[model samples]
Target: MWTIYLGLTGLAAANPQVVGLGNYTGALEDPRFLTSLWLTVLYVGGSAIIGQAGLGFTLAGILRTRTGPVRRLVEGVVLLSWIPPSTVVGFLWFALLDRDEGTLNALLHTPGFAWLLDHPLLSIIIFDVWRGTAFSMMLYAAALENVPPAHLETARLADAGVLQQPRDVVFPASAATS
Candidate 1:
């Protein structure tokens, strides 16, 4: 309601007048706004599809075969990464990526390298992947669990390689859940 009123009546102005579609037209005419929109789409699509889903599924597949403390530790760490509030994570990332006195710079021995400024999109995509992978991992883990051991045993008996077993048996069996 507020946005509609502001757009139609130029309510933001002291001497308000009916501007009709003028505000929207002005925004659409701006190249920077269009570029930002494009970047936003790219960021969202890339982070969800390529980064989170890909890495999450891959991790799930790899971890599915393992048992004991290693699996628990990895899952715990990933969950910890996901469970924190975004603001806290953002602050931690900022501190880690800051050009001056940053952990990354100190470790890399490349001081004064502005990671966030130089690679904002990549940084955020990676951050989003780290933040969001837990959901996909948990989902895929559950789905992978439903894949019958008998099918995997049959694949093994047929001389299927390690990767082939998951690619052929596990993936198809879990496709519905995915």
Candidate 2:
């Protein structure tokens, strides 16, 4: 391990080519790179910022409210997704989303669906959601635990409905921190 590290360090020190802001300027000027960067921003915004946050919050809410067999099973599956290494998750999604006979297309009964080629941004967004949502779920679960049960009890006394209680009690409690 040290040999590989020293070798890479030696290679880097040997070729002390400093381009200053040239590469940054060039990348900014390139249409393809700019477009790719913009698309990446969109992908992160759509998936990590929105999709994962939403799903994680929703799943956390479900785990908090619902009970019994199906909830246990779904919680198990979601927690399983969280435990796997991200590389493993990536490879799994890669194999599942393969263009030719991917799991998704196969399930949809569509053949030769070029998912990555035709919808590269959406594919990346979907994968980001898959690999990142669990983190948000775990975060929310912990946050939800800190919420005061007295708030919920008060909401119940006020005849708040299922969703209404969370809206009135939980969200407001967590809003400042969030």
Give the winner by lDDT. Answer: 1
Q: Pick the candidate with the highest TM-score.
A: 1
For model 2, the run of ten residues with the poorest summed lDDT: 3-12
| Clash number by candidate, in order | 0, 0
Off by over 4 Å in 1: 1-34, 156-168, 175-178
Model 2 alpha-carbon miss at residue 8, Å: 28
TM-score of predicted structure 1: 0.74
Which TM-score value belongs to model 2? 0.69
| Residue clash pairs of candidate 2 | none
TM-score of each: 0.74, 0.69
lDDT of each: 0.90, 0.80
